[model samples]
Target: MSTPDPDPDCPSTPTTTGTETYLSGGCHCGANTYQLTLPAQPSPPFPLVDFDHCTSCRRTSGALLQAWIILPQSWAVFHISSTFDQSHTVYASSVVTAGALRKELGGGEPKSLVHYASSPGVSRAFCARCGTHLVYSRVYEEREAGDGPEGEGDGEDFVGVSLASLDKDSLERAPRPLQHTWWGDGVPWLKEMIAKGCEEGGIGAMEKLEGYQ
Candidate 1:
């Protein structure tokens, strides 16, 4: 899929109408700087959500489940020019699955997201500098129009970034609904949160992790 052109009309400064708010953050070294605009009311405290059974996420985070959030690519405005200079690395665990989908269904290769290999074509991306887990993109076999190659293919273009790793104030700005993923691979401890009906993207878990990190 073609990337939307940087809106020439896109404002240099993001707009805030009280409905939407903007947040800024970067890696520990400040190399991978970025800004995102999201709804401000119920801010997402924890950026990490469970990718329950995703193998790649397990390997990358060294945890049973991978947690992430989907943000509009437009919300992500980066200062660095290239991911390479910023110390980006790519994993090819699931490239074959991605490649196959592109060939048969015509979905383009994954974009600037990070990659981690659980197996071929089954990689996940995270911030190289600070280890902030990002999005999980893979190639699945099903190819129904508008779902796979033809349509957005489960919203592949939607980029997921780790909320735990972002700057604190920024995390408080653009709150989002927590989303559960790959439940089959989820760890047992997460069930406690589910029992309490914890919201998906809330920062409760992230704060606890910060004490250890």
Candidate 2:
């Protein structure tokens, strides 16, 4: 599938409240959902988004180009389902090391989100029902458990949320993506499509929007 222009209705508007910012997103089938929070700052990077033109992303997501939002694992919380109504515990260490986690939610697995090992240490998560690519995660440490550092993964675990899965309101309120990655792998028409999308359906009009100006 080709990466078509973003819907004009989702104008990339990004929202803010006292001392914090938030963006809501999910899959096409409402099977995967999440809320991303950005701590208050002098200037908020509400949408630290990236457009990925990598072959892996394109083939897996079936889109011409994949747009992803970069977030630190510790900086965001995720909930599954159409509505953000579920709960779980995060184990920076092993859940077994902590008592509260065992009783707080289901077994210690990424709920409902099926993951595929896209590479040796990279996992690509997607919705089992709708096939919407949710998040791409990469492991930082590869040594066997108890053999490497105290933790199974290095502190550098990363998360990349699919930007196209965001809600219309969140999309409209979101900041423009930071930049395009793997642009060289994209088709020759990719740049023209982006420019056209910006002019017609993307964040090009955002600067003129109220408050943003």
Candidate 3:
């Protein structure tokens, strides 16, 4: 997919409150639904962006890396009351040392954050039925233990959801992605574009290799 253009007049500061545009999206099965409120201009700490070269994300989405939009934990809403069957099948890709992956995957953990082994401490959640990826979270060790990999105190919670899986037109007015990450795992041609600061394809090369896979 082509990257969307960034708003020229967008601002860099974060907003505490305003009449922002709200958009909604859900899974193909409609089991998972979410709503996001975007600023009229570029808001620092805006929710979504593209992630590149994340191994678990690449495998899960079958794409170079998943597009992640961050939603305010307060503003984001999930409704699985009626679709529990579809919602329950969601899988946790890696093993957790403290608890069962399923238990660690859900809410209510003191310092829980979904994690993928490739990106340790980074947690990812996805649909169990159609395999639609949902969100990713990470532990907040800074506030918890003063300084440590494993947290000891209460940590802030965060999630990154796949923009493509959202309901239609939800991101119609959102800002374009701002950065690319994990470029090391990105295919060679893609790496070249990054080196040259070009925003176009390495897709043709990827396509050529598809037949072999």
How do the residues 1-213 of candidate 1 rate in per-residue lDDT, one tens digit apiece?
Answer: 222222222222444776866655544443344556666553333232333445555667666555455443444554431333333332221212222222322334433334465555444555444555543444444323443112234433334555554566555554544555566666556655664454554335334554655
Cα lDDT of model 2 by residue, 33-138, tens digit: 5666666772223335788888899999998889887655554455443222223221121211111211222335444456687767667777655678888765
The superposed Cα distance between candidate 2 and the true structure at residue 203, in angstroms, equals 14
* Ranked candidates, highest TM-score first: 2, 3, 1
Q: Scored by CA lDDT, what does every candidate get?
A: 0.45, 0.58, 0.50
Regions more than 4 Å wrong, model 3: 1-18, 39-43, 81-120, 142-155, 193-213
Task: Judging by lDDT against the true structure, name the best candidate.
Answer: 2
- Per-residue C-alpha lDDT of model 3 across residues 97-187, encoded as one tens digit per residue: 2213335446553221333433656566654444566666555542234532123223434456677766445556555677776666777
lDDT of 1: 0.45
